[model samples]
Target: MAETTGGVIDAAERDLIIRSQAGDRAAFGKLVEQHMKRAYFAALGFLGSHDDALDISQEAFARAFDSRAKLDPGRPFYPWVYQIMRRLVFNISRDRKARGAKLEAATGWIVDDLSARALREGPAARLERSELEERLHGAIAGLADQEKEVLVLKEFEDLKYREIAELLEIPIGTVMSRLYSARKSLAKRLEGVV
Candidate 1:
């Protein structure tokens, strides 16, 4: 079966993983270029801050380069890299939680960029949509790490259950369970927001 990824990079991932495993820096750069946006957004979905997301994602790439020997030449590269990323984000989240909540989340991070033009068409509709979005953001941010990860992969990253399971190294049933729990949490959090 063909590998699926966020973009055209899937076809090149195996060759790039092989080359990078042999210490080809240029090959790794191509891999980075291909996957950076996906990595950044993945981190953003976890960390919920643009600066933290960018930093953590870039650091994950650097660390992946350092540990390139462990990368399997026959496997898709992204899932391996995502392990590093998820760990980093989890650590950072733990640290932040220990330090207590601050002003980390803001409206700028979860914006729907296209909402502006839509807003011009209907003021009441815009207000309702904005409120719902705010509530949704709050709900997502409050989710436990595993639940949040599953939800983001399914809803934002648009990964299939099998793909999420493969990437996270969990069973497909576990992916469905996590997704179901995450959705239930979001629904409870959203409550009656309209």
Candidate 2:
């Protein structure tokens, strides 16, 4: 029963990936449907704009499809897609800066539904939650590029420390230390806010 369940889950995931690789539009659509919101949120968290997030998400999938044969079926798809999105965002940021353009944060951008849902509960509760999220975002933005990358991959992407170390091509101990420092710095910044 245990093997059967695992096999069924693996089969389903592989089928989707295979069909997508085979140029089945519906299958590709299903893959996108499964991952879109998560990818969008990740992009938004990094790029800080709905428009840029949408563009990055779309471009990532396009690039993935174009290079589908390069993907290893044994690896999880989300992380691969996220890496593409991260690269695209970085490129966009670099290009904008090269053109003497400044990136602006979208004003009144709520990170997610939790803040709005909390608002419906009560004003005092909502205010506190919003302040915390704002502080957290600010702290994350302030982190060095490598530190922020490690933190986001470990925390938001739910990657294991070893997986992050592998992805970042750093040692496992380095991943742990970076995450610890990232959290510590965030906590210190948040303490002043709250």
Each model's number of backbone clashes? 0, 0
**lDDT of every model, 2 decimals:** 0.82, 0.72
Per-residue C-alpha lDDT of model 1 across residues 1-194, encoded as one tens digit per residue: 22643222344677888888888999999888878998999999877899999999999999999999987666677777889999999998888778887437655677674467558869887777788778877788888889999988987799898778878988899999988999899899999973
lDDT of 2: 0.72
Task: Report the C-alpha displacement of residue 180, candidate 1, in angstroms.
Answer: 1.3
Q: Which ten residues in a row have the lowest lDDT in candidate 2?
A: 1-10
Cα error, residue 54 of model 1, in Å, equals: 0.7
The TM-score between candidate 1 and the true structure equals 0.87
lDDT of 2 by residue, 47-70 (tens): 667888898999999998888888
Angstrom error of the Cα, residue 89, model 2: value is: 2.2
Give candidate 2's TM-score: 0.69
